[model samples]
Target: MHYVTSKTLLSSNNGMNLYRGCTHGCIYCDSRSECYNMNHDFEDIEVKQNSAELLKKELLKRPKSMVGTGSMTDPYIPIEKNLKYVRKSLEMIYRYGFGFTCITKSDLVLRDLDLLEKINERSKAVVQMTLTTADDDLCSILEPNVCVTSRRVEVLKTLSEAGIPTVVWLCPILPYINDSHENINGILDFCIESGVHGIICFGMGLTLREGNREYFYKKLDENFPGLREKYVEKFGDSYTVSSPNNRELMKIFKKRTDEKGILNDNDEIFRYLHNFPQDSVQTKLI
Candidate 1:
């Protein structure tokens, strides 16, 4: 809910975060990790006042690459309905003839479908959505302020039908909470039906660090009472709080994704996401 003038926009790797903090009340958000060093409250979103202009500058100077956003914060937060920073950036990216991709959990992305379709037509545009759980009730608990799982699946399918490829981040699977076979299978079924181009799942567990770990534990105590003690006993001070069923869950994940021919390899998917497609009609830079 605050604004600051930023000097730069895109990263050396062609990624940009239009906002610094997030409003999405995800209980397992790793962006709150102490490693990031945010100066404001997590919910007090910090908007880059000059994002569109800065992005246009960056896009004009750099060679064509897949520009990405929403790494540290979701670009489609409710404020986006008014701020339109993400939409403006997409306009610049499309106008500059750069491929675009973003990771988000909001259906508000549908608002910019026109620009996304245009970018994909000129170069490439991939929309990546995160689906943590298939159960809408659990999704409300885990990623509380965003669209539910079913709605995100609808968004994915909508993007697919629009000829825009999509990727899904199936991650942060909490142990004892959402690590069962039924949960993983349900999420995987949703992905398969949505025709997602790739799925990036590091493992069947979530990471916990100094800042995020405490916040996650606090939420756990509030929601799943006494779960904090269980975590302390199981993964005292570990960063990667992996699920006990990581092996078995990963087995199901790999089998389902592989059978559906969806991209499951992280490196391969990153390559697909990062490597700017040099297709005949899409290579001309503005």
Candidate 2:
């Protein structure tokens, strides 16, 4: 973990990545891709030492809107236990009356449940969790370093009970691995039980770019021997690796989400996430 003074925090889209790299060690992490051109090791974790102040600066001048993170990297990695950068930023977001959202796989998010509930009451706070597979054993093999699917589900339920909305990211369905009806159904069942507001799944596949592809193949060889050769023979440098059962699997996904009335359309979900309730804004000062 290293700290550097950053000139800015929020992106043009209003997202802020307080930490640049991650320590959760998910094998299929797209952030490791060379296209990102990260200057240091993926585990080094660049910290914006001034994130709270920087974010406050922007939040003060800007009109109320949603502020998000966890697109480029997970903010609740182990080091966050002590750093508390995410917690600090959330305090500021609440102080300035901006909505909040995040994508993470760790149960540590529950530690901020108090702040999340407070923000939801004042404005909005939506937590988006990644659930790639339902089976804990397979989840261990795929995500490796983070909490399992069951634990994430529990967190989602807890958040929902607190009146904070939650979303699930069902993605990177490794072909020939987790692309089964049983796996999809198991995950959707968890979502329904957790009462998630939406589930974002872009087909039944994962993207494999240059940097992440190599790393993913290495992990596959170590865990599922001969899997790398199979992927190479099939995908062969393609960026989007769709599963053979994409059509069928998507049918199951849509049917389950539709029946439950969960948001299935990506655009609608994103719009919901970004569209702050106009009436929720107020002059809450720190």
Q: RMSD per prediction, one decimal? A: 1.3, 0.9
Q: Model 1: how far is 210 from its true place, Å?
A: 0.8
Mind giving the per-residue lDDT tens digits that candidate 2 earns over 148-172? 9899999999998999999999998
Write candidate 1's Cα lDDT for 1-286 as tens digits: 8999999988889889988888889999999998999989999999889887788777879887899985789889899999888888887788777898999999999999999999888889999999888899999999889989999999999999999999999988999999999999998999888899999999999899999999999999889999999999999999888999999999999998889999999999999999887771543445
* Candidate 1, residue 43: lDDT: 92
Error of 2 at 276 (Å): 0.7
TM-score of 1: 0.97
Query: Model 2 off-target regions past 4 Å?
Result: none
Residue pair clashes in candidate 2? none
